[model samples]
Target: MNYLLIENDKCVGVCDYEPNVGNDNIQVITYSGNIPQERLIYVDGKVADMNNYTFINGKYVKKTKAIENLLNTNDEAKHYLNDTDWLVIRHRDQLALGQTTSLTNEQYLDLLTKRQAARERVVEYGE
Candidate 1:
């Protein structure tokens, strides 16, 4: 399945690959450019191309269903200082869903800009 990279504002390849966790059920995943499999984020369920990737701060873990909502939001991009922070605290007892690396705010903004340009081009061409 294809997933949207909210940070990069581009189409990223995604798959339902499982971690070494032996869960038997496939976890939906998002694969961004050069982002190692171990470093990508996995949330339960699937997302359409319209959904977005977000960086959430360390504050919202215990809030039930917060992660799901974060992924589905339109304009807001949540973030944590480091990717590991979310993994460690959120997925501690559970099997490691996947791996992720830190993406700086500047890097993320650049991605959005690119996405906007691409959108503009599509509109111009009437695609």
Candidate 2:
């Protein structure tokens, strides 16, 4: 049976075997053996309970669905932005001259309409 090793009321690691002889100085054989008794406070439940937590930084932290979703969303957004070529446009205002930058799809569409109107003016005036 699996056992969770607790240190200072926090789960530190997991062990496969519980000590056979004495409970006073119990030895838990984890992936990394010879964990000192000073760092080991107690042993928690079996494998079923251990599934609720993830081992991180020598401690078992509770895993949440929300945190997982947020992490996945961030990864997907990074990939999407990297793969896609976003449109860059310059602002038309005289005050913000000499600045060119990429814009989102909505901003690009707005600028596209203005550009089409300017093209129409050039065609009609021959300039």
Highest TM-score: which candidate?
2
Q: Lowest-lDDT window of 10 residues in candidate 2? A: 118-127
lDDT of 1 by residue, 5-79 (tens): 322322244444533424433433454445443334333332322323433442112233655554434222222
C-alpha RMSD between model 1 and the true structure: 22.0
Question: lDDT for each of the candidates?
Answer: 0.38, 0.46
Q: Residue by residue across 24-73, what tens digits does model 2's lDDT show? A: 33344343334344333332532224445544456555559964555455
RMSD values, in order shown: 22.0, 16.7
Model 1 quality (TM-score): 0.19
Q: What's the TM-score of each model vs. the native?
A: 0.19, 0.26
Q: For each predicted model, how many residue pairs clash, with residues at least 3 apart or on different chains?
A: 9, 0
| Candidate 1 local Cα displacement, residue 38, angstroms | 48
Give Cα distance to truth, residue 76, candidate 2, Å: 1.5
The reply for model 1, stretches above 4 Å from the true place, is 1-101, 124-127
